[model samples]
Target chain A: MTPEQENQIRESFDHQSMMTTFGASLDDLTPGTCRISAPILDGNQQQHGFGHAALTFGLGDTAAGYAAMSVMEPGHEVLTAEIKISLVSPAKGYRLIAEGTVLRAGRRLITVEAKVFAKDAGENRLIAVLLGTMVPVKPKPTAT
Target chain B: MTPEQENQIRESFDHQSMMTTFGASLDDLTPGTCRISAPILDGNQQQHGFGHAALTFGLGDTAAGYAAMSVMEPGHEVLTAEIKISLVSPAKGYRLIAEGTVLRAGRRLITVEAKVFAKDAGENRLIAVLLGTMVPVKPKPTAT
Candidate 1:
């Protein structure tokens, strides 16, 4: 990705308050790919003291969404139309890492997939997988 | 649902710290059904100022999981196996309410669905829909 394109994606991600709430960060960005990571904290745990499914879904969705956004034109943002996730393993770890990849980029719809891994003590275990479609939308005109 | 069943569901929900982090509450519970609500706070917004999709998915998934749990045997809990969510509209409202129902209850897997509504000025608009499967699990033995 170009420097300008990377900067655009970074700026947009920075404006998302939900990421701040989860303490998630954009770890890497390349054309048609993205990676995001978040630490496991007490606040994002389920009743069993494991990372919540919502946390897993959140990071995966955002990572995949940004992967779609990376290929969009300037001023075009992507919104999730639908997403499906499968929790394969219990999320017991110190942190979670999500890797997103774009399968196809079309004019209106983009197909993306994300794999989430639970990282503990230098080991990573696959916990979840996500597939989704995103729609690109141009920014609305501002009132004069 | 019996009083004991209600208590079990409520107690389990109370122990989930992710719900507390989202400022969500369990609104109602009946046999094979559940409802959850959360306000649209600033901390849970996307870059466009609308309620983040993660918040909507979280509420819907939790409500559906609880609905499945309501029908399970005592000392049994439900965990999400797979979930699919469709965001039909932007979440711009005072709060989001998710209503969950069981489509089928089986020995191991329960099929569930949830409809999320955005409440604005006391009017509710459909924002998202979710379908998922939950697996019933017995508590593990505790060490003496």
Candidate 2:
């Protein structure tokens, strides 16, 4: 994807309300890849003082969608069809990172993978792995 | 599981932050089963106006965890270990519901399945299915 396309994707992501609710931000973007990060907040902590699994999954899922969108044409959009996430370890940290990469990009469907990391004490620890399928759809007309 | 255990599980679910963030609530609770529902909001929607997949998965995953918890001992809690969700149809609706049932309840690991439904115009449409594993753990003392 070109720099212009990347900016477009970023702009679209900004329109997603879930990102604002969770305070997640796009950290990096490249061809067929993207990363999202968020600082750990009390609102997202579970009973164990660890990051909630759903919050982690949401970040990873969004990153995977962007990774697939990074390779699509300007007039197309990507949506998640399915996803599987395995929590490898408890996520206790100052911030969380989700790095997504497209494994295969096809005409209609793109398969992607993501790795979730927790940054604590200046060290990043692997926390989860995710696999997802994203489908390209016709662009929705911009709202008036 | 007894009725007392079911009520205990319900109390725990009420404390989940994701549920509060998305306005989801526990609709029904039974032995080895649970149902969660939420009114569709713009914050949980995608570009095409369909409910976002991550929101749906989060509901289903939490229901699955509660399904397992319902069968556990009083002092234990269940946490999501892994999950696989397949979206069968686009979710367009006024309300979303997720039904979860335990497939197996072992000493430490439990397997569960959940179905997500979208209620629109007085009709319920199946949108996704999720298979998940939950691990039972000793309850952690809440921080003061």
By DockQ, who's the top model here?
1
Residue lDDT tens for model 2, A17-114: 66766788999999999999997777666555677787788889989999999998876677788999999988888899999999999888899999
Q: Chain B vs. true chain B: TM-score for each candidate?
A: 0.95, 0.93
lDDT of 2: 0.85
Off by over 4 Å in 2: A140-144, B140-144
DockQ of each candidate, alpha-carbon based: 0.63, 0.50
Residue pairs in steric clash, candidate 2? none
Question: lDDT per residue, candidate 1, A1-144, as tens digits?
Answer: 677878878987888888888899999999899999998888888888888888899899999999999988767878999999999998898999999999999998999999999998899999999999999988787511
Query: By summed lDDT, which 10 consecutive residues of candidate 1 chain A come out lowest?
Result: A135-144
In terms of TM-score, how similar is model 2 to the real structure? 0.92
Q: In terms of docking quality, how is candidate 2 classified? A: medium
**Candidate 2 RMSD computed on C-alpha atoms after optimal superposition onto the true structure:** 2.1
The DockQ assigned to candidate 1 is 0.63
Tens digit of per-residue lDDT, candidate 2, span B65-124? 898999888767787899999989887888899999999999989999999999999999
